[model samples]
Target chain A: MDIDLILKAINITVIGYIIVFVVLFLLYLSFYYLAKLLESQAKERCRRAGKNKCAEHDKFSVDSDTTAAIAMALYLHFGETHDIDSTKLTMKRESKRYTPWNSKIYNVIHRL
Target chain B: MEGLYRFLEYTGFANFTFGHGIMIIVGLVFIFLAIKKDYEPLLLVPIGFGIILGNIPFIQNAGLNLGVYENGSVLRYLYFGVLSGVYPPLIFLGIGAMTDFSTLISNPKLMLLGAAAQLGIFATFLGSIFLGFNLNEAGAIGIIGGADGPTAIFLASKLANGSNGNLNLIGPIAIAAYSYMALVPVIQPPIMRLLTTKKERVIRMKPPRSVSKVEKIIFPVAGLLLTGFISPASLPLLGMLFFGNLLKESMVTERLAETARKPMIDIVTILLGLTVGASTQADIFLTKQSVLIFILGALSFMVATAGGILFAKFMNLFLSNENKINPLIGSAGVSAVPDSARVSQLEGLKYDKNNHLLMHAMAPNVAGVIGSAIAAGILMSFLL
Candidate 1:
């Protein structure tokens, strides 16, 4: 039962928890304000351009599947090749072997 | 006959001990659980095989240089990454590349749940001290509560890696952290159910506002500066994480992001898992302290889960009914990533079909990752 060691441990834990919370809280505030600033900036840009539908565009989003599908359609429409295969090809020779049904000798024996 | 006797002395049967037999069975159980139960198979399989490899008894004091602890052994050389605290940062880089911060950026207040869950780490520190562990050992052991394996290993390697008379505890701490992370589905649901009312579990949150591309690009850079300024010791980890995210968000570095998230991460994970598993030699790993670490780890998880769940409920008092959060997602604040998030979704489905909480849960889940890294930095500053 070391009292000094216990005191040190308690001090560290309290201070550690406070620091973690403060740092995260600060992060939260920064992000909250950043989001607000970005929103206002977008609004200003929309007003200057004389467009009423800027918020509408911001609200619109495409999921990954739709994006992929659109990309594929564009690729096909443009007639671009996605895959490039090597022009050089190598071939190997194969020897034919006889099966019971295919063999001439077997057919002759059956006829006899 | 004499030559035959000499050969017999070199055999596995001649060198085998009871400890080796127990460890071998433990390895087998890990493999079986991975194959049959589908519990973190990618990590557990490599670790399980490494365990069996390490526990294969060899002749003692023979300069064979075959074991992981032996000088010039291949496994030992690979293990230098873990010992020197290199692998965790690389793992963070991969995580950052793959993770989408849209949910978190759109809903920042959920970050509080992530911060609250860190109560487990501090609570475990106090518990460890009461149990007579020194400050350094207690600090290293406490991070098991983060429910993130790499962070735990990173902290342990720095604080308790058998240097300066500190107990080397990286192996047990890593095993405990990963084990609890894998068991998130089992561990978290019960606590979530216990903490929240049935009505609270079924509450639907407002859909997150779509994050703009510019916001995504700016987030990592801003995050890096904010967190790095607060805890510079965390730069190695936070810097790599933000850099990986920037590579993904920059749109021009897609190839680099793809490589970092896919192949590079996979190779590092294999090396980290195998070396960590092999480091658990029977003589060093099987001890009273190891058992205490496991117990404390489980307690840490429970406390962390409770802390998140309670904090969510506490926040509900301040919000309007439309903005009320489903407390079940609070359990995702422990940083097990999508596993804990999935638990929230599944539990939500049980109460009401078509109630999807996965997206909402992910906000706190990712936040927990950052929060734990920051917590690790704090511990390092104080204890180290």
Candidate 2:
């Protein structure tokens, strides 16, 4: 192997890994700050919306424990015997419906 | 009798070779895997059928224009999208529209795992070079570790575009990437098991906070600007991805989002898969280099899986016991998307039921997509 080629490959690998980590790390910082800012804004909005509305706003931030509890409650309520629907609506025509235009007597008689 | 003899000369029986027979069986195997095993059927089926279509022996240079490589062929025209790096970004648009970034937004630290898994990409670059491939071919081959078929195809198209007397590796690389991606369930778990302890696998992370609509709307624009500036070479792909995401998040462009994620994506996937598969003509595709590429691809995937798991464990050293993340979710750092995450979920369940890691695993899974594209950009800038 050429010495220059090996060095070039090493250089590319180090630089490539660094750039990927840095870009994603920067995204992490941005999202972290964005979440903080959003949380504060939500708090302020709730403060203006009165105590009742503030309580409702809090529901969106449920902890994992509460979520698990809610899930358990729902599971207990519904059990496992729910109806299975494929959500597909298939129309099966047993036979062609009798229509005035298609009636045998009308066609044969030529009533008009 | 003379006319009949002329007709027989043009028949497939006259034209068939051992290579065609082998390639046809390979095609049938792909179709079987897709239909029976349910392994990325959406891709495998089209590719499988295309392989059969492409390998149907015909007289060479007969002005038939039937082969994918032949000029004026319909398959060749469709292949232009892949060769020119057009189809991957369009597929990215659909991925963006369908993807929900809330999990990532709620917990950003997981993005590092996505970055960590890219170790496989870089590592494979060195490996390919050591194996005697040129810089550009190595770079194209390295992306298979990213476990993202589109990124692999895109980078291979650009870096190994077959210009300047280089080998046209787009077909082999694409097939390798997609094949490994479909086998994520098979490839990742063993590595995941090898790396993590039962206690680590059973660790349950907290549920994500619900993101506000405003934050959701702002993320795509911010993402586009940030990643776009850092790796402009990736803009063609990242730009479309974020644009499709913006259309989805904006709420006003629901119709456009629907179209992007649904019908448009489906059409492009069919074209990309079929053309890519058809590009694997017996004479062009089966080579010693193709075998080497497959080996390197599998090694890269394993390295990527280990990198994610190890990185998660390293992060755990800094985190408090209560805040520790499941190391199995680390495997989701490879850019296979929901599949890697699903593996995490399944593996986690094996250790402890009622511990749903899907939502948490998604953070890294989606970030891996962004990370791989950035890596592709960096490689393109350097190697191209």
Q: Top DockQ: which candidate number?
A: 2
DockQ of 1: 0.31
lDDT of 1 at B265: 92
Tens-digit lDDT track for model 1 on B105-168? Answer: 8889998888889988999999999998999999999998888888999999999999999989
Worst lDDT window (10 residues) for model 1 chain A? A62-71
Per-residue lDDT tens digits of candidate 2, residues A1-112? Answer: 8889999999999999999999999999999998888888888998988878888877767665576578679989889657986899999877545578679965665645
Name the 10 consecutive residues with the lowest summed lDDT in model 2 chain B: B158-167
Per-residue lDDT tens digits for candidate 2, residues B78-169, read 99999999999999999999999998999999999999999999999999999999999999999999999999999999988789767899
Interface RMSD of 2: 1.8
lDDT, candidate 2, residue B129? 95
Q: Residue B262, candidate 1: how far off, in angstroms?
A: 0.6
Cα DockQ of the candidate 2 complex: 0.47
Off by over 4 Å in 2: A62-112
Residue B319 local lDDT, model 2 = 97
